[model samples]
Target chain A: MARTFEFHGGVYPPERKQRSQGPVRHAMLPGRVVLHLDQHAGRPAFATVAVGDSVKVGTPIARCDGMISAALHASISGQVTQVDRHTITIDSDGLDAWQRLTPLEWRTASAEERLTRLEHSGVVGLGGAGFPTHIKARVSERQRIDTLVVNAAECEPYITVDDLTLRQYTSDVLEGAQLIASLCGAKQIVVGIEDNKPEAISALRQAMAESQPLSVTVSVIATRYPSGGERQLIKTLLDRDVPDKGLPADIGVLCQNPGTLLAALRSVRDGEPLVERLVTLTGEAIADPGNRWVRIGTPMAALLDEAGLNRAALHQLIEGGPMMGTPLADLEGVVTKTTNCLIAATRKELPPAPPESPCIRCGACEEACPANLLPQQLHWYARAKDDAKLAHYRLFDCIECNACSYVCPSHIPLVADYRHAKTRLRHQQLETAKAEHAKHRFEWRQARLDREEAEKQARRQARLARQSTQQTDSQGASPQADLRSLRIAQTAAKAAVRKAEKNLARAAQQDPQQSHDDLETQLATAKENLQAAEARLAEARSAGEPQETP
Target chain B: MSDAFSIISLLSAVAVLTALGVGFGALLGAVSERFKGDESSLVEQIDTLLPQTQCGQCGYPGCRPYAEAINQGDAINKCPPGGDATITALADLLGRTPEPLDGEAPSEDLVAFIREDECIGCTKCIQACPVDAIIGAAKQMHTVIEDECTGCDLCLEPCPVDCIDMLPRSTPLAQWQPVTYPHQMIASDRRASMEMPHGTHL
Candidate 1:
């Protein structure tokens, strides 16, 4: 029985799914693989292996340095030929020359040892972002999580790699999920599968019954555009609205991808690091499009060719699902750990969108938005270049699910508009930050200039006093000159006192309760100013001139 | 005699006041309409949001005229700079927000950087700039008016030399959301396994 959901705005988009669903097939590995450093969203994994070093399949090539990054391994046994700014290429050691063995049996090691091995295996969240699985396990353990959610939603249209994986490797996926649950010390596990795939759900249930943990539950969720979205899936299955900007872990829950769990099980039980993944190759233009087990760092062109697709038929080769995928400008770019699906389509299969017409004030997009955002209003604010207004309408809340664009009768690429507007807003915000930093730099420069000017004046006053004292000694016999020197000293002291008082005044404005030490410093400065001013006044009086005024 | 005198006086006072006030108020509103212009006010505001670049990026003759058409309930987001933001503003003005201008246009902070080495001096980018930001003779390398450059990136398409590259503006630290959103972490973690047997929970 297929599970369906309510309140979802999805079109029965023509599923052109005929190309590659026959049987699981493997692609020929390339002689040289270009592994991009920043394959995932987080911190790019730093390359641990150097050029000229020989690495075997499952050899740790890059190590995770931060909480966000993932570790990388050599997909094939090869010599590292080139590591440059954009990519790292490994020329395969011809025909598996290095040792390639099956994953070790885990029963040989204790649970703690097994866990340690899993951590050292360099396994990350293979489902997509490549977050370190070990880190997540640690989080789950800390949170005292009671349940682990396994996502087999696979909601993105035309992408059935996960569904195919479950069909073939349901037991493996379950085992991976169980291993993760054990590591996290979770009590219950729930695998949420979308209702569209009844066979996968039945296969999962059958695997669970023969399995020991009679407690694992499988729930069929309604199919929706974003039902596959982690937050939405969690909400639908658990009835928990993960607080905006908060993680599932915050709510004592953790969700893992179906593929990631399988990888984790293999890593923990089999002692293997992730080296390859199942990539979905589906699109109307392709001669053959289906799920194929592909090695990481496989060139897209090569993968398409392996899938029996002719490049001439494919007008565009896109990375990921048709709805939210990015168009690959260069097929030379190799697949990374995050490459889940590669869709190859001809223009005729998915025709170019019609020319955009003026909005007739129709509210179709808002009605279609799953996030409950006023997409129409957002578009308006976005069009006006008003970032503030866009923010006010909660533009950041838009998940870019493409449902809005899918429903627009006018054929507007609504999601693209939101993305572009969002990108611009982010860029402007960055500019604002740079401007603020520049402002601070200018202020600091000005303050430094003021300090230097003050210091120069202080030095000049000291030098003048020294010269006057020498003059007084030289003119010791003249009473008038002696009186003049005494008066100059008094005036200088008074002037110093006045300057100190001004400093005190400014300080008082900044802080009401001046410390005794601060007050004393101010007094001292004031005394110096008073003395200097008095000295000049006295000198003027002794010289028979009018006394210097205060 | 006393009762007849009171009634007559009251009736006489009411009749005089009602006649004078009614005649005066009616005369004032008639004078105001004669001075008021018949031009529509809403059309002027919509014209401002149009890029005014007059680059024909919108497939319109000019921006102000496009605004006039939009004021009459045309699609928003025609201007690339205005992009989604403009659509939103127009939506605000017209009291409707719809996905209208979700089409493709270069809407980033991009200014044409002349590749000094590859300049054939075709002066094509200058002709393409709707804002007249590019200044150069037909045979000389052109310079972009940095302040005037809206970064619409219209010049990039027309460059025969392909010298113009729309460099992605650097995201300052403040605006850089941690590239890894939490949901991706959760999603990736849930389905990380590729080889698990069907229906089995880890």
Candidate 2:
């Protein structure tokens, strides 16, 4: 083994592997299976099959819906009974029907072919995150992958699925490693296991010896709880520290679970899709405790019944390993592709957690925390809801591995508190983002309103200017001046004509008794004068034409 | 001879005081130069503090313009989308008094949904949009980008056929947080929590 580096703060829990040492058992298919579309990270897949539709084993019920999402397949042949939110319920037909499987010959397959096959196979990080395996298989062209770390460190107490996989499927695991390395352009493959699993180590070594051209190394290190952590494992075997907020790939290494490798191998070599996986069913509450190759979507209740669980004495059921397990409230909850172990415990074997007491300020949590965070200080900041202080302390870095909670003599339920705080923080961030987005939209609206208002004002001003200019051009002179002069001239002409008519009438009256020839002649003259004045007024009105080209 | 000695002492005292003053003044000037920090970057900082709503509630056209205004002595409380939280943050950032919102919270986060049947295939609302969030061509029914809509109500007046209506965008799940909600053991949440084999903190 390469020179190992010392990590800060850890706890040594009693290892109880001897509690269940039976060979791998194959579980019978349950009456039904509930496949969650959100079994892995990223966007949830929408169901492709409707209720009452028949589906067989390896039939894709939901397509991968996102860049970082995985597809869902029917682990058993059955008819879809119900399709709820992000979940598909399939009732078993017991006929063992399956979809067509066209295996890819890994030796001759192209990189793209291998990736597509693995993607459709529905394999993920089986031991931990359950991240889509295909996404991890091909690193960016910018990154040249040189090392592949197969995590066989079953460091978590009471879980031994990887160990069995290493022992039973040794050659297949090696072959899968070879295929993964070739795809990622890796030249060195390191399999990190705890020194305790001697049998698994030897089996892997023997397989490596038989393997022709693959440069594989089995590095046995100290049995530590979180030695299997991607960062910690890399540091232990390679002595290279993965920078903060960085992935193993950042340091030219890609870490994968043994079970994932096996699944990958099966997909490429046998053209088999990942429908089922091995799950470790153990805990003192069960009659039988051992590793089992269980079908995906098998309900927890079914597994408990198979293990002969004492329902009367059951305390709490935990999913995954004890150090980092979630207390499952529903027995009806079905198994997902990521489900690796289920611990149905009684009070005697797994007692209920004690009530939390005040922190004594003892430095035990600091000593046990693998991340080197100040747990007590974090607890204080979390309770106070001090987001900045929490960030300053790197609260997001907490792995929730429960090493702090396990070592705390206060029984403070530290892990639960941290998880709650983290969730709250995430929710707060999302709210802040929405608020920011809303502000942008609102401002944009205001800007539009202002712009429109300005435009309207500008249009009104332009219209006013155009009307004024048109008035000036159309009138022979200024309209006000021309109207004033025309009115004065017309008034004078009317007064003059009226005066002449009055004179003629007077003369006719005076000569009423005598001959009226003189009066008649005067009247005719006055009429002619009036006609000439009217003509002048008409000509003045007609002359007002701005339409005439100057 | 004694009078001459006194005159020499007075000149020496004046020279000592002048030297001390010059030394301290020069030190202060150098310190100021070294730590003077960029002032133009203040615009970006203020912009970040302002909710990027692009809403002209602050009498400015967009968030960037508003940020510029704030830098030039505009009131911090004029944002409606940011409301009091934003005002308080801005005040904290700019070291000013936190004031109440200038107007009723800028209309709630909304998107303009055009009633297609009544829409005369006129793109009036599209022209009215500031962010160009509305997508459609002339004589085509227009739709708003829900995510990009600022809900400024600018589109409502321009639509010839009274077809445009402002509807509230659904509040994000995170915004629906309750007082003192600490991962309560609710029945609905129990089954939904993922099966992370390791610790729950990601």
Candidate 3:
């Protein structure tokens, strides 16, 4: 496919990729593995095995809660040792032998049976999308899927595990792609590789020719950072722009990373859950830099040591690619399901910063931005802390791709400004929610008071009527008798008024009122309500609970 | 006889005008170039606004390098920092229409504040900062120059500080731009939160 649109805002840094581009080798199992619960974007996995339980390699240690989370398995045979809020650390001690844990003998299951076994296994998309593979398989079964795009575009620099996977285990990667296509019932399969990895592509092509039909095709992508981004890759290969918030499925396309495909093949055929992953540990400062097929939950520091990168001279330990990666502080943090690369660099490989100066309105950032955004304008509004203007400009849609910052001549951290503004806006939203909640409570309280006042008025009217009837019967012609009863009723009403006054006073003390006028008005209404209620009660006594007063 | 006379008159007039025009053009070109000084300084100033990750997301090799291209009559809105804020600033500087900064950077309102506690003394942030604003060591705490910080936030991502939080700058009545100082002060700190680029300058 030809290059489509003018992608502005790009940087061409020194390609230090050869550091980890060699053959992918497997690292020996470590003594301990710390599996983080939240290895994916959605909900965390639930541990099926308790802390004291024994686990074997590919053992189902935990299960997925629902569609959002994936199940966890033991990468190595071990004993459940520790469980924290978000991670579980297992100690590897026994069972060095590769033995299948499934007593049901899942390997012998048919293709349909394999799909069933996978659902029970709780396998998810290990391609970093973390979508449950069973769901994808099931969805594919319903529709006539045209193609299965196997994303080998490990476009993020210093990440060549997929390349190594293709070179060393070419058969595995291809077989997995075929199985996924057959399972999903797709008509065609395309394994997208960035042009830089020609050897891997050739190896994959050779492997596909032996067993499967020519349905499996190898396509090369331009070597650009984030070329492996699902949407970007889809756009690059298919010339289709998946809507900003749309999925590939919406456009009748399905994409999966090479690593994720291999995992799916292993899970369906072997009845294995996602337990191990290929991690690329390389950087400039690293002493031994290459790709390592490590068990999930291995501490980054341990892998660093294996890669010969010590924590001493290291300047930064970033998870994933330099372009769109999270900077991790402690090297001791465990690798999760999505971690593809751990980049540790020195000052030389990644140079030290220059002093920041004022912006001179140079347009280089705009020209480099791939998304075609005006990075300069974003910087201006962000610097001024004008969040509203930022929102109006669709700040939320920014991919945080770092294109603007990379192209800026002023060394302005444009992305950082955008992030800060978003976070602050989120904080503002929470504050607003809290205030509205309080207002709702006040409105509820006011409604209750109104209802109680109306009830009291009805009772007061009934009581007065009853008193009049009782006076007529007791003192046929005696005005003096009626006078005495009226005085008694008046005294009772006065006491009721006092009680109402006391209740109002108590409420006032509990919550101080700044508007005395408002309080006075409320107090006056309460008193009037109490007076009417007392009159009704007096009448009710005289007439013995008078008939409903209209 | 008439044709010959007309041709000679026209030739003489054209020759005189051509000489004067060439002389004026040459003089103006010489004056402009002499006063322009070096364009590099302007590029250097623009480079400071970039984060300097050299990720090429902006289509340039690095931040400073992009600035040079900008001084050469490139579009001013490319740098995300000079986004809307940068555009307005550029308009103020060069007199142009202020366009909104592009939305290429997702959720662009983030700021980088070093989490002092989590800092591991790695000077990655300092090195990665296109502008050497972060000050710390291979294993010491780093501090940001608040006054000097362009608020471009490039330093945050490289911070081993998990600490470098991109806190959005809060706007108050005082912070509004096209900034008017020592003049009329808007009452109510309920300032408009806009998506502008870095720089406290109006």
| Tens digits of lDDT, candidate 3, B1-202 | 9999999999999998999999999999999988886677766556544443333345664455566766777676676633464566565665667666655543544435777888888788776554344678877788775423345555666655377866775553323333322211332332322212222110
Interface RMSD of each: 16.3, 7.4, 21.0
lDDT-sorted candidate list, best first: 2, 1, 3
**TM-score to native of every candidate shown:** 0.60, 0.74, 0.57
Please give the lDDT score at residue A161 for candidate 1: 76
Quantify how close model 1 is to the true structure by its C-alpha RMSD in Å: 16.9
| Candidate 2: regions farther than 4 A off | A1-3, A435-550, B1-40, B53-69, B74-84, B99-202
The docking category that best describes candidate 1 is incorrect
Instruction: Report, for all candidates in order, the number of backbone clashes.
Output: 98, 15, 117
lDDT of 1 by residue, B67-168 (tens): 677766666766665667677767776778657565675645555566767777788887666555678887787777564555556788888878876565
RMSD of each: 16.9, 23.3, 23.6
Per-model C-alpha lDDT, please?
0.67, 0.77, 0.65
Candidate 1 lDDT over residue span A250-304, tens digit each: 7778888888887777776666667788888877656666777787898887777
In DockQ terms, which candidate is top? 2
User: Which candidate tops TM-score?
Assistant: 2
